[model samples]
Each structure stands twice: as C-alpha cells, then as structure tokens.
Target chain A: MAPPSEEPTDGAVSPADYRTLCDLLRERTGLSFTEAKRYYVQRRLAERVEATRMPSVRDYLNLLRFQASGAEMQLLVNLMTVNETYFFREKYQLDCLVNGMLDEVVRHRRPGERVRLWSAGCATGEEPYSIAITLLERWPRVDEFQIELYASDIDSMALDRAREGVYGERSLQALPAELVERYFRPVAPGSWRIIDELRESVDFSLVNIVDPAQVRRFTGIDVVFCRNLLIYFDDLGRRNAAAMFHEALSPGGFVALGHSESMSRMSSLFVPRRFPDAILYQKPAEGAGA
Target chain B: MGLVKAGSKGTLGTAPTGAAAPEDWTALLEHADAGHRRHAAQALGDRPDAAATLAARLPREPDPAVREALLTALVRIGSPEAAAGLAPMLASEDAGLRNGALESLQQMPVDAVEPQMDALAGSDDSDLRIFAVLLAARLGPAERSARLHQALERDPHVNVGLTAAEAVAELGDPAALPALEAFAARFPDDPCVAYTVDAARRRFRGAS
Candidate 1:
C-alpha cells in the first residue's frame, strides 16, 4: 500500500526544523553546521531518512530527538562525521617529515633500533601508506633505518579496508605517477591495490583513541600522525587523548596534528617545533618537562 | 631490516584486560612516573565516587599531563561535587592551572555546574566573576539567561557588568532591553559600556 503523504509532501525539512537538528547535533557532537552547509547536512540526513523508512525529514528529526535508545542518533553522527580521507592529504607535514624531521629522529637512535610511526586515525589506508611511500621515495637514506609503521582506527570496518589496501581514483589523485606505478598494481579500471609489500608494511589495528588501555599498546613511537580526528572531540576528550599520546610516545617523539588543530588546546605535554613547511610538536628530550 | 611485517608478535597487542580497583588507582595518584600517575587519574575518572580525590590532587599536581588527566577525570565524572572541586581553580594564581580548570569546567553540563555558580560569582577576584558569567552563558538558554541576568543586575565590577550585558544581549531576551538601559546608567561616562548597552538595546528590541 502507498504511504500516506500527510507531512511536507516533497519531504523537505523546514528551515526551523533544520536549525533545531543542527543545534541538537552541535550539543551532542562538537561539530558545527550552518545554512551554507545545509546541502551537506541534508544529503546525509536523506540517507538516514530513507534507511529508517521515515516519511519525511521532520519525522526523522523526532526519531533523532526523542528516541531514548539514541541508536539512530549514533548512526547519524557516524555518517555526518565520516571524513573524506585521501592519500597525501596535507603533504607539507610529509615534506617536513622527509627533509628534516627524519634526520632529527635518527639522531638519538642506536644502530639496528626500530623507529616506530603510528597513524592514530588512519581511515582506509591513505595516510599511513602515504607516509611509507614518502619515506621510501623521498628520504635519501630511507633504507638505513628499520622503520615500523602502525595504523589504527576506532572503526573496525575502516581497519579492514586499510588492511586490504585497495584504492580508487579519489585516494590516488595526489600520488605522483612514478610513485603510483612503483607502489600500486591495477586491480580494475580506476582501481588499484597496493602491492603486497606495502600492504603488509603497515600493521592495521582497531584502537579507540580515548581508551587508555587501548592507546597504551604501542609505546616508544617516534612519530604520531593523528590528523583531523582529535578536532571532533570535546575539550576533555581531546585532553584525554593527548595525555594518552604523550604517554605512548618516546621521550623525544613528535606529534603531527591536523593543520587546523593546534597543540595549545590539546595539552602542554609537547613543545611546538617549527619545521620549514609545517609546525609539529615534540615531546621534550629526557630530563626536561613541558 | 626493512619495513617489517606484523612482528613475531601479532599486528596489534591483545586487548587490555582488567581494571584496577578505585583504591589501587587512587593510591597511585602520587606515583613517581607522571605517566603512571596520569593513568591512575584516568582510571579513577571512571569511578563516580573518586571525584573528591581527583579534585584534591588537582591543585598540588605540578605536571601538566597529570593535571590534565585529573581534570579530565573530573569532567568524566561530572558530578556536582566534581564541579565544586574544579571551581576553586578559578581563583588559582597559576595561569596554566586556572585556565585548565576553566576549560574543563566549560566542558561540563549545566546541572553539574549550576550549584557552583554562586560561589564563583561571589569570588573576590573580578576576573573570576567575569569567568563565572562566561560559564553561566555556556549553560542551556533558560539557565544561561537567568544567571547572566543575575550577573548583570548584581555584579559590582564594570567589566563583569559589561560582559554580562553582552552575554545577555546575545541571548536576545526581550526584557533585557530595560536591563541594558539601567546598566548604561551605572557607568555613565564609560563609552565602551554605553556603546555595548546601546547595541544590546537595539538587538533586544529588534529581537522582541
């Protein structure tokens, strides 16, 4: 039977209803939305609207607001907060790593010691793989050190994809042709699977950044690239994660945050070290305090 | 060795199992390693009963990391007592500790923070009073307006009054027009206050 069309017949969410939704979303998550972002908001809301089989966005709003279980709210948040991660996303930090940071990192390392790099929220393999390829391709002495790369995400499904290490054009658009040819093999039209060597190079795991126990697994990491993820957290959540990162890092390790994020708000555990291209935070060398 | 595959050990370590008792965690709050002590604070934060212990350790905590862990734990607990514990840091002479406390308090919900507002408003320091108004404004609209109006009406410092006036104006309360006009009279010669009050008048009347 056809459903009754009692609501706004076109399934449009009124402006006031949209504002209420944005306000509720802002309260629950720290993310902000405005009229300029209505298209983005509505597109995601439409997916949930259809998935729930709700007649219109207004009723979907009721499901989001009044539902005691808050399950659908979580589903909406997951969708809304899904960042479109791509390879070499923000490469200046990578440049900083290759040119100067790597030299400084190896300065204190003993011969045959492993240097660990962690991708705290590596969604779909782009970030960690980018780092690996940059080291192999850019750093002149890349082969001299035994580098261990670790990538993790709270979402298991994302980790699964990262382990599979396959990508489409969206993820590969930033890679240089030679690097792409050297690293990836064509799986299909417009699809490439990272060569088995690179796939196995990064160890993908599921980790919730805020959970101390979960975050404690990797100690003595030399570099942590946690781009764009911490910005979603509230102040306390950010601080909690920062403290965890600080504890997990080795004495003189470095943290690279998203371009928009500053160490100032996160924690005072690390001192800001400015590289030629980007700013990074360095945990003090031993015998010093932040 | 080149980029090694998941080591002889598995890719990731086993999930962390077992939690320490609140007492165990609390005892370790004074651990020598800042990392150990920070973890203790994080563990106690999960215990709603440990708010006072976490709060008590906050002022004496010299390490910024440990102080952060303590403040985060209190924020996680979010009890009224936790709010009260964090409130005194508003009066701290140390900018880092005081600012950390303010940021942490801002993360708390209104109910958790409501009881402490009076103490903050009555603080001898005017900066604390201004911070109290800002904290009140972070509350839900109904409470935010009420507390901000209270500050506008009763605060002695011109700076506090001005901040309250601006915050109330932002709330766009219809009744705040007369309140703003009265506030302008209190600082008869101060152009900044006069300008702010005038601006708030237009906003309130326009909003109404």
Candidate 2:
C-alpha cells in the first residue's frame, strides 16, 4: 500500500486551514459563515479529529473531502446544526394557533375538507405535538375532524428523536399537568415519552427549509408554524423561505412566525394581522389584499 | 380541610381526617405507574399548582417528560409565584430545563415579570436573550424602553437586535425613532426591517 497521506503538523494548521474547511462546509451544507462560527467549527472538528483517530487536521480534512459517505455528511451537518426548541415555544404564537387560527380554519373548512398543518423546522417535534395536543384539548370529538399534522426538520437525528416523542422531565414542565399525564408515558429513570396517541398524530420527515421545490409540494396547508427559525438565514434565504411558505398556504390560510420574524421586508404576498397577543400573516382572502 | 380529606380517598395513602386531608382532587392525578404520568398530568388541568407539587415528587420520572409536565402546569397556572419559581431555571445547565423555563416565563404578563426580565436580557444564552427582548417589549415604564434601546445597541445576535429594535418602536418613545430608522437602514434588504420601520413610523406619526 502507498505511504499514508501526510498530515499537517500541529503548528501548521492555521486560519487558512480553517477558511478552507469553512468553504467546504458551506459548499456542501449551505451553512452561512460569519466570524462567530470559526470557533464552533474548530471545536466540533477537534472532537471529530480525535474520534476518527486521525493524526492531524489535514488528514481529517482530506478524509472529509474524499471519503465521507452520506452518513458522514449527515453527521457533519447534525454536529454543526443547532436544534434549540421547547414545547409550546413562543406561547403567544401557539395562542394564535389554538385560539385564533384554528378556530377560523374550522369555521371556514368545507365539510369533509381535511385540515392540514405543517410545522417547518419543527426541531425534535415540540411544535407539531403542541398543535395536536391543543386540538385534542379544544375539540371534544377531535377524531371526527380530518386533521393531518406534518412535522419536518433538516436534521435526521432530530427527526428520529422527535419520532420517539420521548421527553425528559424538563421538556414536560411547561405542559399542563393534565396534558402531560394524558399524553405521555414514563419510559426510563427521569424520562417521559409522548404516547402513541399524540405521536401518531404527527408525521415526521427530514427536510431542508431552504429547498423551495420540495416545500412547494406541500400545498393547501391550513396553517404553517415556522417560528424562530428564519432568523438563522441570510436575506436571500429568508426571502426564499418566506415565498415558499406563502405558496404552501391555501388562500386565507395563516402562517405564524417566531415573534421576531416578519414578512414585510420579504414580500407583499402576505397580509399581516394582529391578534390579542400575537402577529400572523394571511394570504389575503382570495382576490383581496394582493 | 374537609375537601382535602374527601379528595384523598383511594389515593396511595389514607388522608388523616380534619387535618386538611390531601385534596381528593389530588388523587385524581396519581398514575398507576410512572408510565401514566402524562395522562395524569393532563387530567389535572386548572390545578397546576397541585400538579406541580406532584410532578416535583416523581424522582424516578424521566427528566424531560416530568419537566414538560411541570412546565405545563406552571404556564397554565399563570401565577406570579409560578413564574418566579421558573425564573432561576432559565440558567440551568440542562438545555431542556433552560428552554422550559424561558417558555413558561414568556406566558406571564410583562408587568408581573419585569423584575426577572433583566436577568434574561443579560443572559449569555441566545434563546434567553431573545425571549427577554420580547418580554421586555411588553413591560411599561420608560426604563424598560431605555433598556431595550441598550439591548438593541449591544446584543450580539442579529435577531436579538431586531427584537430590541421592534420593542423600542412599540414603546413609541420618539427618542427611539431615529435609532430605529438607523437600525432598519442596516438591514435594508431584511423583510423584518420594513415592519420594524413601519411600526416606528406609525408610532412617530401618532406622537406628532
């Protein structure tokens, strides 16, 4: 066998090396880079270096370039991505969902029209589960309604965990005692899992929010919860995502964003509406606000 | 007291009569096994304080699920004390705990939560910082508005900056209008910037 590839000596790994790594990551994963991310990359790759038994950073970089498989690529993506979320996160927005948006949807939905919701960037599944639980709580005969909940995240690991629907004591804390006891089952020491009833209500998939074509496939959705996540992107990314959400929603459907997110700068495609405590956007009643 | 005794029947332990017997309603919350905690928790709606007490006792419970239950109760209760109880957990080392605390705090009224708002605004964690900015927007007193201005100037996260800018605009402090205009100028291409600017302009026009 040929001699092993040369690895960069300790002192030789410089800012230039890091820049190359950043470029490669951006090229492959579409993650934007700012000065702040340098440290995160260094720290994450440092751990990977030790785990791979690579003698140096240069060798690791080469392996990543030439030998990385789909799984390895996914691992790299997951490591770099952050999935920070909680149940009923941004309650004001959920309030809009249960008290305002859902009520309106139920009222206008033609008899037998299946109401569907998509929670984009759902992060370990809290948003969608929250939606399902809210419906269950609000509608005494929820089974009589045709409701489909679709939850998607870019991270497969998060999707897998979300599918499990098992949360720790902390994840359940904000939940009302009744919902918790009713919806979850204790699995291990200090681990409570969402029951099949709630879990079954959601369909989890791995999806990138930046992918417009894939997003367009989801049409006629009654409501979309894409909260807090749009802040991560650059202007182009945000605009793309916003336009996609606009297209995905049925006319008169609502989109709830993170408190900080707004559509005013991106497009006139949505008409903003203010509820008691939250802001929502509606694809103006057919032929109206556009 | 009599209600407590009557409520305690069929519970794990017999309630001592006339001694403020454990609320029988409390027994309605006990699951046969930890496996049923979610169901029991859900059944205890409108009684979050009592449910919180029970949730705090489940040592063998899964930490995330139990925390979720406890947090649910706290938010539903919407009591000042419940909000206070969750304040410190915002700094928890466990991400889940910190997140749960932040979520619960978000549900509270801004006036009732002004005291703890500063700590969150000053947090190193981005989630806490963002939540604090939003919460601060709901608070009164010129000081809260001033603090939001400072946060807009100093926060490292762009999103935090945007939230602070929006909050300042909401306060309708004419003093904030120029700054909001300048901030909006920076993100000329940001869709959110237009909303922020429009809010500030509306406030400025209303004040005039």
Q: Candidates' TM-scores?
A: 0.79, 0.54
What is the lDDT for A249 in model 2? 76
lDDT measured at residue A285 in model 1 versus the true structure, 0 to 100: 79
lDDT of each: 0.82, 0.66
TM-score of chain B of each: 0.85, 0.56
Best by lDDT: 1
Evaluated with TM-score, which candidate comes out highest?
1
Error of 1 at A13 (Å): 15
TM-score of predicted chain A against the true chain A, for each candidate? 0.77, 0.85
What lDDT tens digits, residue by residue, belong to model 1 across residues B44-86? 9878899999999998898877888898889888889899999
Compose the digit string of candidate 2's lDDT tens values, residues A52-162: 888777777778888846565566767877887767778777666766677677785554446778898888888888888777776443555567778887788989999
**Shift of residue A10 alpha carbon in model 1, Å:** 15
